[model samples]
Target: MPPTLQSLDHLVLTVSDVDATLAFYRDVLGMVPQSFTPTGGTARWALTFGCQKINLHRAGHEFEPKAKMPRAGSADLCFLSDTPLDAWQATLAVHGVLVEEGPIRRTGAQGPILSIYLRDPDGNLIEISNQI
Candidate 1:
């Protein structure tokens, strides 16, 4: 039988500047930034939120076994937030993040969701949504 997917564990993001990307996710999106080293390996960075995480690889210095076309500013990711849309607007305002589009109705994986779209430091599209 073919395998079925259950849930997402993590994903990788290619970034231009690690510090800027880390700062945006950490300060603007409330994700926890972490740094760790593999056994006999170099340091790596990740951003954690809830049960998921995003591993970071520098654009010109990606680790081994990476994407065939690893490029910065190439990802579009959506995140589900329990926080209200109004609150999210305020938070974005406080952070000076420009809204590319949204606080509009959209279809989500489970159901309808209200979403707001913006760009991260690496110009990756970021969508923050709340189930309605």
Candidate 2:
């Protein structure tokens, strides 16, 4: 027998403000809020976009105080979209999301691809890439 693999289940990110992060993911990214809870005085919000579920957990308390700035170019998670590169870029721009640079051409394991990268409010990198 061989080890079988399943699809990605979720991506969790620690945020300074859960409400604001939820708004960005929901309002800007057009994801839907799936659930939220306050555990031990910190809020946890879950959102769904397409098949991906993103969990935002509030950080700032005795157990989980604020963290240092994340490493530049470090992605908490990367999301792929079937939407055209230009359209996605325009959409991000409209939401005031700054593009660090790209839609650059590159060769991937699967073949050629185009990608653009940006950062969220918490300084988490997000790359929007598509096969070219």
Candidate 3:
């Protein structure tokens, strides 16, 4: 029998500008930013949302033994939002983040969802959605 995984823990991403990435995720997206020192005694930054987190590595400074071909703009991620889709659109508007595509009906793993898409500074596609 195969071992069953529990829930997603965290994921890593490479970014050209750590400051911009942190600001976008912290101020615009409302994720909490945190810093820590890894085993090598170097402080690193990450954003946390509930039980999950996203660790960011500066482009050209990724940790060793990572993905064979890690690169910025290669990540496309979705986040579940409890807020109404319209409210999300408004919040995004406040941040001057244009909706690349959005308010479109889509099927989530749980069922139907209303989703909107945006791109981060590194051009990573981010999908935010709410279940109906």
For 4-108, candidate 1 gives per-residue lDDT tens digits of 999999999999999999999999999999998978889999999999999999998998889999999999998999999889889999999999898899999
Question: Tens digits of per-residue lDDT for model 3 on 1-132?
Answer: 999998889999899999999999998889999998889768999999999999988888987667888899999998999988788889899999999997899999889989999999999999999998
- The stretch of ten residues in a row with the least summed lDDT in candidate 1 is 33-42
Model 2 clash pairs? 103-115
lDDT of each: 0.94, 0.71, 0.91
lDDT of model 2, residue 71: 31
**Pick by TM-score: 1 or 2, better one:** 1
> How do these models rank on lDDT, best leading?
1, 3, 2
- Model 2 residue 43 CA deviation (Å) reads 7.1
RMSD of 3: 1.0
lDDT of 3 at 27: 83
Per-residue lDDT of candidate 2, residues 1-132 (tens digit): 999977888766777776777787787667898765556664456889888787665654212443364232235455666888789888888999888989887665577778887887788877777887
- Which sections of candidate 1 miss by over 4 Å? none
lDDT for model 3 comes to 0.91
